[model samples]
Target: MGFLDISHVTKSYGQVQVLHEVDIAVQEGEFLVLVGPSGCGKSTLLNMIAGLEAISSGDIAIKGRVINGVHPSKRNIAMVFQSYALYPNMTVGQNMTFGLEMHGVPKPARDAALADVAKLLQIDHLLDRKPGQLSGGQRQRVAMGRALVRNPDVFLFDEPLSNLDAKLRVDMRTEIKKLHQKLKTTIVYVTHDQIEAMTLSTRIAVMNKGYVQQLGTPKEIYDTPANLFVATFMGSPAMNILPATVVMEGGQPHAEITDADGARRLLRFSQGNLAEWADKPILLGIRPEAITDPEGADRKSANIQPLANRVTVTEPAGSDTFVTMTLSGKDVIARMRADAMVAPGEVFDFAINMDKAVAFDPATEARIPQ
Candidate 1:
């Protein structure tokens, strides 16, 4: 059995079904992230795992032991909240040891636990300071230290970095990843930010409308999204999905794309067994980074094909330029080097790496297996 198992879990509120039957399995020391937009039930699922929310049906198990109705504290899980959830009046040290002290652990033992975690989290200097006196990141560390002092079986983070500024959020993300490496414990984190999930998770469960849409490693989820929802939801600027038709040209399957102006271009996919899909409509998805300059094309994989779609707009980010062009009636973005200063209305030689390009069944919005 997996270290943590969520089996056929469901949730509802008086005729309103929120979370559908959901299942996820997380291995020991695995960092699993539940990510989706607001109201998608990612937080609700985390709460269910923590025993804060009652499961309407199905079971949750920790190491094969069913914890259906277990109390939150008895579950031996520590939760760090987005708000930090620190005690206003208590100092960092006091906040860190309160749970231990409440359980009647002797003062000496509690102090020892606090000291070790404080030093480990590098918050020893701020132990005596109150949460109010600490910066957002510091307060977050104290909250984490509070959870760490218990040394629970699993760490649950409910969007812990949501309150921090962008740079601090990135820093805290690194710290959390390092902490996981150092402790090698199981963790289940919930967040609406796909970037956080991609950066922090050993595996990610992408949810939508109360259902787990896709669950896989970051690379798996990004490169081979299960459906249109996952393909459009998990990346920054999302994946560019365009309408296309599969056709056979010279015994090989190719996707024919027609822009708004009726200009046509063909993109060949590396996968086989696509001959039967000829003349059928499909959703063609390509990431911005995959459509890059010819020199930047990945040489290792031979899925690189050439095309020149007329650029309609260009957004110059510091490290890369986002070039926008109409592809098969859809606006698609391509990531190019910042120095490639192609003017709008110009047709630039864009190399497309389709080794990872995906096709979806337009009727079901499900990816077509290669």
Candidate 2:
């Protein structure tokens, strides 16, 4: 039996459906991330699992027991909300122990739990201070510490790191991962940030418009997205999707892309199970890294073709430079080495890693090969 099972769970507020028969199974100690844009029902799903929101239909089970109708406190789950939700007047230590105090836990046990969690979160010295006295990151750690004190069957995080600044968010992301590793607890985390989902999740459920678009490991979701929504949503620079038509050239399939300058290019993919997409309009999906400068040693062994395009915009961020160009009448960004020198309006040649490109049906938006 799965440790946490949300079986065909659905929720609606009046006539507006927020979650459409969402289903997810989390293994024991698995870190599952539910990620999507705001109002996509990721947090609603998390709330349902936390028992904060009532399920419109279907069931939720934890540790092989149904908890659909259980109260929030009785579900043996700890939830850390985005707002921190800390007691304003209480010190950090008191906030961390408030739940245990209400549960009638002895002072010794509460103190021990506070000491252990404070040390684990590196907030031991700040325990005597109130939430107002700490930084955003420190308050987040206190919120997490409050959750950790319970050692509940499941931990629900509703964008717990969203309140922090970028640098602190990254730091807390690492802290959460380390805490998960040390505690070996089942965690269901909700967030709108794709990078957070990619970095922290054992499996990610990409939600959109009250439905789950895809659920898979970070690599799987990035390399082989379920549909157009997922492909466009999960990546940082976003996957470069261009409208193209599939044509059979010399008994093989090829994606023909027409550049903004009216120049035409043919990209050939491996032919095996793509016979059905012949002579049809399709969307070609390619990551920015796949189309890069061909100076690397790995480019020699790869089947890539050089395409020349004039750069419209160049953004350098120390490590890599992002160059944007017009391709197939759409803006496409490519990541190149920062040392590579190319200015705006200057044409540069890049090799497209055609083997990594994916094709999607234009009408249905599903992957073509599968």
Candidate 3:
């Protein structure tokens, strides 16, 4: 019921099932990124959409038409591979237009399409050169240009920026985002890099162990993870999770955790529904940024609680300082302003923004719903 729909899609290799009951509805002109660790079946699901891998069961449709049995060429989909996959011997212009030529298109139309896409991708100067003569970024642009000239119904990218250097990867990421905005094309991109997924996708499908742990906008995924796997996987520094107990204090639910000296400390939660979990053990999830120096705490947060703890280590990371301490027998990190004056073995008053805190069912590893 979407522009690109994967309804009850599953893929199996003989007796072993890799992808299970996966469903995603990608809207028109939307950018969807499949992100997870290596061997998590992100690429396998992408291959299924590209018609390179057969679906064991279920259906994949584009614009309401099922393409389950369609050939790769006839599916009206263009793909850009991680390796660029350009012809080494063919000129850039030939490589870009060869697919059109094979479809029996006239030479004039092929030339016109090539010129427009090459200009759009800023590769007009490299059309006469071969793939061997260009830089890594230029070759990537050529690969993208090849796909753009086809005017396919969908564009599938299989870790296309993974081959570039770190700086070039960032540069290409911006370029791809700009291209998507300009053309308003539907794109399904696959990457294991969470940062790439966060920055590029309009929506992200965070997969793990052959399952989509969470599918949501970046803000939703970061702010409210569906489960423990999503909370730990999608962020750069990762969310801090520790064991805690829900205790009622003054008719309000509070998280009771142990500080560095094994002293019981209480931090009130913003979710009033947690009152039902009174006297029950739960896993508390908090992002590093939510725990900060008293002066650096979020001013808008209504539930800022003071938590004094001994800092075990202080890491100055240019823009922000990451302070580490032990709480609930687990290492907890706090992000503070780089200029904050706290050192190792010093007791600092850290602010806990309970407004941004989340609680999880420790046994099921699922987030506690508000």
Candidate 4:
């Protein structure tokens, strides 16, 4: 058993079932992020873990001990909520120590813990101030400090950074990462932001419509999505999925797709197993970074197919330019270096890294194993 285990867990209200057979085993000190869109049951799963919501069935255990019937206060877990649930009338230090006081902890011990955590979170100066006197970021730090003083076995973050502005969110994200590294605590963070999942997680569970679509390391989920939904949901520009047919050429499989000018083009497949799929209709998947200007193509790829296609749109996004063109009657984006001189309505030689390509069964929408 792992440090935290959710086995065969299901949740339902009345007759409408929400979560089905959800299972996850989080190792000690592992940063696991439950990421998905709003109402995907990520928060519900988290609440179940925190004992804020009871499991309809199955078990939730911590350190091999069942906690399904335990109270939220007795669960040995700390939660940093999105709203920064702090008392407006209480000073930061008082708010931080109130939980310990409620548990009958001695004043001296609570004070010591408060001092240490406040210093660690760099909020020692704000300890005497009320929640209303602090800025948003300071209030967040105080909320985190309150949880830190408890030194719980598990940390539950429910979209904790969602309330902060963009720049502060990034700053606090780094702070949280540093805190985790120093403390090495097990954390289950829930966020609707895919970028947070990619940047912060040791493993990610991507949920959709109350089901976990896929669970794996961020790299694995991004590079080899389990299905079409994961592919389209987990990235910034999203993976470009084009309708194509697998055709055999020179005893190898090639994706037969139409270019901008309505001319058919062939790109060789690096996965030799695709040869078995010859003459079959399949959806070709390629990330925008895999399609770039010739000079920006990945040097490690052996199969860099070259194609001259007319660009329909060019978006300059500071560090890189997003070039869009029609392929297989779909808008395909190519990520190119900012200095690449190609413009819209011009025929440009683009390099496609077929080595990074993936394929999906058109009917089932599941990824065809590489």
Candidate 5:
């Protein structure tokens, strides 16, 4: 059995529903990330699992036992919220031991727990200091330390790193991943940040409008998204969805797209099991990394179909560069190596790696075979 099972879980407030018949099975020691945009009910689902919010319908089971009616304190689960939720008046030591104290744990046992957690989190020196004196990252660690001290069955993180700055957030994300590896604990994390989800999760559930759009590993979600929403939401520069028509060329599927000069190009997809979608009205989804400048020697093997287009803008972000160009009357972003020597208003020959391209049906918004 799965470590935690959310069976047809639903949540509603008064007359409105926030979570709709969601089901997720979390394996032991697995890091599962629930990710989506604001108002998508990711946090609501996490809260329900933590017992902070009641489930409007369905059942939640941990280790094959129903926990639907269990009180938060008796659930054997620990939560780390975005706000840190540290007590201003208490020292870090006291904050970490508070839950144990309430549970009637002996003083000697509680002290040992605090010592172990402090050492694990690398915050032993700050145990005597109050939350007010610690930096944002330090305080976040203390909050996590508090949860770690509990030695609970599962850990629920509700955007725990959201309050930190970008650099600190990245640092803390690495710390959390290392911590989880050491502890081998089951974790369910909720966040709207796609980068966090992609980097930290063993599996990710892409949520939208109170429903799960797709659940898969990061590579599966990135390379083969289940639908258009997932295709657009998972990538950094976002997948470029171009309107195209599919036609059969020698019994194979080829996507026809109009380039900037009103010239038509047929990009063939001969990947595994793509013969089903021979001819259809589909949207071509391509990541920025899949498109490259043809003149670059590194992309010699990348099916260079030279498309003439004037670059509208160029953004250099250290390791890579992004160029914006108009294709089929829609703007498309291309990511290339930082050394790519292309300037604005320059017409360049671009090549797309059609082997990695994806196709989605226009009507159902679902991925097609080709």
Candidate 6:
């Protein structure tokens, strides 16, 4: 058994069901991130774990004890909300200790606990100020400090950094990682940002339409997605998926795509045993990084095929450049170094690292077993 287990959990609001039979087992000190787009029911599942929302069926167990019907406060799980849910009327110090005071803790004990958390979060000076008097980043620290004072079994962060600006979010992400490292506590964080999920979690659960699409380490999810939805959702630009037909060339498996000019291109994948799949239509998934300029090809890849393709769009994003081209009548994105001289309406030999390619069955939208 894991430290926290959600066994076949489901949730509904009267007749409207929102969460399916979702099961997540979180180990002690594991940082699990539940990430998806808006209204994806990630928050609903989190609420169930926190006892803020009722589950229609199934069990939620913490440390081997069922907590499905436990009170939120009694769950011993502290939550940090997106809005930095601090009391505007109270000073940061008061906000940090309010929960303990309400629970009948003595002032001395609460103050001691608050002092420790304040020091840990480096917000001692801001403790006398109210939430309104602090910056967005500082208020977030206070909210986290409030939760830390409780010293709960699990930390539930419901998009805690969502309110901060991009730069602050990045900084806070690093801080949260460091805090987790020092505390070694289990964390279940929810976010809509794939980048946050990638950077923060030990494992990420990508959800969609109330169901968990895939759950794996960030690298596992990014390198080998379970399905098409996951392949397209977890990455920054997402994996480029194109329809192609499997063909055999010189007794080897190859993915064939016909260009707009009737020219057929062959992409040899690293995985073998494609004899049966030949002549069958399949979806090819490739990340932008896997397709680059000749000089930009990943040195570790065993196979890098160069295609003379015309660039339809060229977008320079700081350190990297993204170029769009057509393959099999589908737009494909390739990542290149910022210095790569790529321009629209120009035909260039693009290096594609097929060794990192993934194949999916179009009908089921599931990755083909390699």
Give me the candidate number with maximum lDDT.
3
| Of candidates 5 and 1, the better by TM-score | 1
What alpha-carbon RMSD in Å does predicted model 5 have with respect to the real structure? Answer: 1.9
> Compared with the true structure, what per-residue lDDT tens digits does model 5 show for residues 1-370?
5899999999999999989999899999999999999999999999999998999999999999899999999999999989999989999999999999999999999999999999988999999999999999999999999999999999999999989999999999999999988889999999999999999999999999999999999999889999999999998999999998777778766888877677887887756355566555789998998888875434434444456678999999999999999888899999988989889999987777886788898999999854
Question: What RMSD value applies to candidate 4?
Answer: 1.1
The global Cα lDDT (0 to 1) of model 6 is: 0.92
* Pairs with steric clashes in candidate 1: none
Lowest-lDDT window of 10 residues in candidate 6?
267-276
lDDT for each residue of candidate 6 in 1-370, tens digit (9 for 90 to 100): 8999999998888887788899899999999999999988999999999999988999999999999889999999999998988999999999999999988999999999999999999999998898999999999999999999998999999999989999998999999999999999999999999999999999999999899999899998998899999999988787899888999888888999887889999988777876689999999999999989999899988999888989999999999999999998888998899999898999999999988899999899999978
Q: Any residue pairs clashing in model 2, and if so which?
A: none
Better of 1 and 5 by lDDT: 1
* RMSD for each of the candidates: 1.1, 1.5, 1.0, 1.1, 1.9, 1.1
**Which 10 residues in a row give candidate 5 its minimum summed lDDT?**
296-305
Q: Which residue segments of model 6 deviate by more than 4 Å?
A: none
Backbone clashes under 3 angstroms, per model: 0, 0, 0, 0, 0, 0
Q: How accurate is candidate 1 locally (lDDT)?
A: 0.91
Model 2 stretches astray by more than 4 angstroms: 297-301
lDDT of 3 at 108: 99
Please provide, for model 1 over 208-237, each residue's C-alpha lDDT reduced to its tens digit, 9 standing for 90 to 100: 999999999999999999999999998888
| lDDT tens per residue, model 3, 245-306 | 99999999999996556789999999899999999999999999999998899999999999
lDDT of 4 by residue, 1-370 (tens): 8999999999999898889888899999999999998989999999999999989999999999999999999999999998989988899999999999999999999999998998898899998998999999999999899898999999999999999999999999999888889999999999999999999999999999888899999999999999998898898898999999999999989999965567899999998899888999999999999999888999999999998888999999999999998887799999999999889999999999999899999999999998
lDDT of 5: 0.90
TM-score of predicted model 1? 0.98
TM-score for predicted model 4 compared with the true structure: 0.98
- For 236-261, candidate 2 gives per-residue lDDT tens digits of 79999999878778877888898777
C-alpha lDDT score of every prediction, in listed order: 0.91, 0.89, 0.94, 0.93, 0.90, 0.92
TM-score of each: 0.98, 0.96, 0.98, 0.98, 0.95, 0.98
Which parts of model 3 are misplaced by more than 4 Å?
259-261
